[model samples]
Target: MTISESPHEEEPLVASIDVGTTSSRVILFNKLGQEVSKHQIEYSTSASKQKFASGGARRFSVDSAGGGSAGSAGSAGSGAASPSAARQAQQPIFSAEGIAIEANEFLEIEDLERPTNPTLTFPRPGWVECDPVAILAHVVQCFAANLITMDKINGDRVSRSLLPYRVRCVGIANMRETTLVWSKATGKPIVDYGIVWNDTRTTGIVTEKRNSTPQALQDSLRAKTGLPLYSTYFSCSKLRWLLDNEPAVSEAYEQGDLMFGTVDVWLLYHLTANHAFVSDVTNASRTGFMNLDTLDYDDELLKYWNISRDKINLPKIVSSSQYYGDFTVPQCIKPNLTSVAWTLLTDFCSRSPPVPIQGCLGDQSASLVGQMAFKPGAAKCTYGTGCFLLYNTGTKKLISSHGALTTFGYWFPHLENPEHSQPHFALEGSVAVAGAVVQWLRDNLRLIPKAEDIGPLASRVADSGGVVFVPAFSGLFAPYWDASARATIMGMSQHTTASHLARAAVEGVCFQARAILKAMSSDAAGEGQKDRDFLEEVVDETYEKSPLSVLAVDGGMSKSKEVMQIQADILGPCVKVRTSTTSECTALGAAIAAAMAYEKREDRVLWEDLKDVKKWIRYGGVEQGAKSQDGSAPSKSCTYKSQSLDTDRRRKWRLWEAAIDRCKGWMDIVEEGTGAASNSAVKSM
Candidate 1:
């Protein structure tokens, strides 16, 4: 079955709430993991651009590293400004230096500290933020909207069935590392807006931690937690930044009224009426304070960050697929939660029981699960506002030798032991900008009317014509891990045209993804050889074959046939690409977790084994010259079969590599008010 096709028959459904960078969406899935119904609500818009400015989509692709998307180029930071103000704020200059904006020129920020509505604002260069209130409101609105959508689609299946009872369970997947805090008593946001995952505002904090601490301690930070201290990309630093910068938050912390969490904790608190104060293992792992081995907040690590215990309320860590709790219908609705909308959600739930939101995952990890990468060797990439490639290492906790990160893939404690119920670890490589680069072409450069126009625009020219664009916009993630690098467009000549520039930008994303895949493969090979000295049977996954052998893909930008084809050609080697044509794998993964929770609660088995999940999901792949286990033709899918030669791939890589050298170290970024960057051994790539 296709994404547009859904069965209206009597079938139980699970729901997933996807909180991305640009929008919040809800999707209902049957047991087959096919979308039954869904609804999406985009967050806010940014200021318009001049003829040579940037994208109007208001994307914030920071080093904040959203769980799934481009910072998730998402977040509910939707604020519409005056036309004049929008035009005035943008000061686009084509300088001899290749940067889009001068460092001083980007200081024309508006009063985006607080917003009454859904508004996305950029307070500084390389920073993206959203109003916390708007974040919750949009999420609830998506849920409410999905309720209406399901009823209309379900038809006779629902005989006056209240929304709470329409679905058995729900799951939530959101951008990772996007930090939020609120008053525990009033349930109101603490800061003016929540710090988006990609916001690099906390870069100063990262520099301080790495510099002040002894070299030995700095080295062990990654040993204890499979993450490197790159920039302000996690929750702990953002929380600390708030405590120091926002006096109100510091006062609240002292007064014992502060509650800090990622987007997951914020949503769970509101959804369950502030009852479910829990963060799943996946979300908790993203916070720098969480110990990767213990899967809980570490006191020493917290002390390193100066996070006091028994002062602020942190969410209790839980399994990714456990029954956290059931949602509670709020008795009173605020302006954010309207009476009519709440009424649309449930009166039946208020009278009886609310729907159980049992599954939770970070966006990228959820995409892995949604793609059914249950095996350790499997991997998937999400080409959202930011692109993330997560390689499943099963129970093996293989850390990246390259700049890539090691993280908890997913933890399904509800599943039987036969499926290996421990938390899965992964090696992750992230490109801070993907689709946002395209948005730059649309809203800023005005090269095209829509984001999709890049495909046709690129096809206008046979190739990039030797032009190369390296978008190190938010520094670089994954193997390079360079934080000082700014964007650079190299190789442009007198012969270059708009089509050449457009195609080069598209190729930039593909090349970045390729770099990550190569790094992941290198790491996997090293781990396989090293771990064999201590362990056995660890060679079955990526170590046994090539890393990223079968990359399951999803996200907003993955829909482009041109983009996928470019990715295949650049990949060069023989690889099978399974594109999630539905582009909702992140939501599907969350729903699957919810389904697992529901099944465990009812003592029923959804699949004979967890490995069979991909088959039930509405996925059919088209493989060229490939046969099934039973020697039958492979299932049909929107897959790309590449005839890319090694020489061509190398040439593209060399072009990108040259541009990267020119772009790196363009900015000497330092955290404000804490210390100078000179004191630290920070690599500002």
Candidate 2:
């Protein structure tokens, strides 16, 4: 991903912030949704810039009540949207030790922002833990980098007027289920590490929760929350794990000082300086607490998880395309910019929050929207650290009988007619490990020199040559949600070579996608039959959805021609992702949502194209961009229109299922190899 600065131009641009598993990225997009300029700082690649994290010298915006405007050094932005922006919001200002809790008395803001190589740490073989502080720090640095770029691009315009911030709006997309708990009193982490979405630490916890709950209640939870009680991937399991295991967190929880949030909530809370504490529908769906139908937190689900909203500051759930809060600059980093640029930013923050963070979506949902999968039957699959397949379900929620998840596609509430505003839903399938298997071959097996080399190496082999690689490193997820499963390679023989292993590794990902697509087809087919009557009555084209006909694909693994080809050949429908579309889809989706929200808030469409949902989703408005999807634009996408014969596909499917059976209940063996990643975080701090 060329997340590097591009030549500046004179146009209003929206900004997208993506906080992923290993890195944080910020990209600027014009009204056309084309990348204008970008900056990325992988946690492992950057050094600590604590000075900027604290906005320099542990500075606090004391509010207008403190004898200064929101822009004053001792105060922060006090807009109605920003809680910390006002003096009253900053109550109980003293630390437990009686010192005013401006900075040092609370979290080690400097140490927390420190960079560490190999950002994610393995606490146990199957357990993954990441420093929550480090995550926040690295993201702050990412924002600082982008703010500097903004100064460069608009430096000339700034001298004339700061009336309109060139960076018009902000959108956030994050690893949805990674969970964190911190203190509201001091705003410090209750635990040493955050339980990442892919972390398997909650396996035992989930099993216990399932065993204790009655079958009917379990079924009810699944039906409402759209997440299985036994799934370890959701945030509920993480929050439960801490409550049951971590004494400090338990104590904090009981004391009413604890707060739980996914990465999105955490980002919203801190970025807004404690002003906005909420999650969009997409992120909230993964929290395992929100009701799938109502798009609000379910009381039963909360009671089941033992999460007392009164005690713990659970983030309020909101729509994906709505103004949740304004973004106050993280004055912690003094970016390498001129005094004039810094002054301009200071001025912007003072006049009001620099930008309104009006949009947010889970990464996968953002990808789905970015792919313009607006109508039912439209679907998108993201092949990132893991693979996620999401199928749009329109306003209807089709509870998946298969292992796929029923979640939000995106929530765009009506601006003029609140009743007209409704959520678009999706059925999702998850593969716990995808690109990581390729990384395994590169870093662990040393079978390939680089990640990109795997594609070429795999292309050398005709097929897996009877080998089947089950990349259930932390157990299987979606369509076969087995947390006890372990990684296994079956059917290997003396004829096997590194190339063959490469082929198997890449095919493994495709095979998983095939499984999900098959399951989704089954689930969606049933819904199609059930909704025939509904479809007959509906006039809107958005409601016309069935099983995914053409699967849109993206992410790092999608770049591998061989991988894409194998995926295309296996799935019934075609696989397509545009050349400039893979890496940028998630960010672009967030940008679109932001623009949509801005349009609604302003009570007018931004451009003629945006007046139509189809055209708006297609072109991201009328602004012509380098990303034009017209016939003239060259396509790097690979498509396999014809599926392999049913007999052959069945044979491969059987082989994959058999391999999955062989790896069940092997987490115990895997646990011995992984060390605590939190320990490294502690040392860095």
**Best by TM-score, which number?**
1
Stretches of candidate 1 off by over 4 Å are 1-10, 46-115, 158-165, 331-340, 351-353, 528-545, 598-609, 619-636, 669-685
lDDT of 1 at 158: 56
Task: Compute each candidate's TM-score over C-alphas.
Answer: 0.81, 0.78
Q: Model 1 over residues 1-685: C-alpha lDDT tens digits?
A: 0112122323557889888775577777776666766645443333321111354222221211111111111121122233322443453321111112211111121212123333465667767787666556556555665565565565644555632225767799998998888899887887778888888888778877777888788768887778886566778888888899999999999999999999899888877844798999888988988888888888988888888988899999998887776765443333443444466566535633456778999999999888778887788988877889998888878777767788988988766774457888888989988877876776568787556677778878867999899878788887787777888898889999999999899899888887887777767767646562322333444422454566777876677787788777777655666787456789988987776663343333334336545555643332335565777654434787665777877887888888887777767633332245444535553
Residues 476-504, candidate 2: write the lDDT tens digits.
88888878787889998999999888888
Worst 10 residues of 1 by lDDT: 65-74
Q: Deviation in angstroms for 475 in model 1?
A: 1.3
What lDDT does each candidate get? Answer: 0.68, 0.66
Worst 10 residues of 2 by lDDT: 61-70
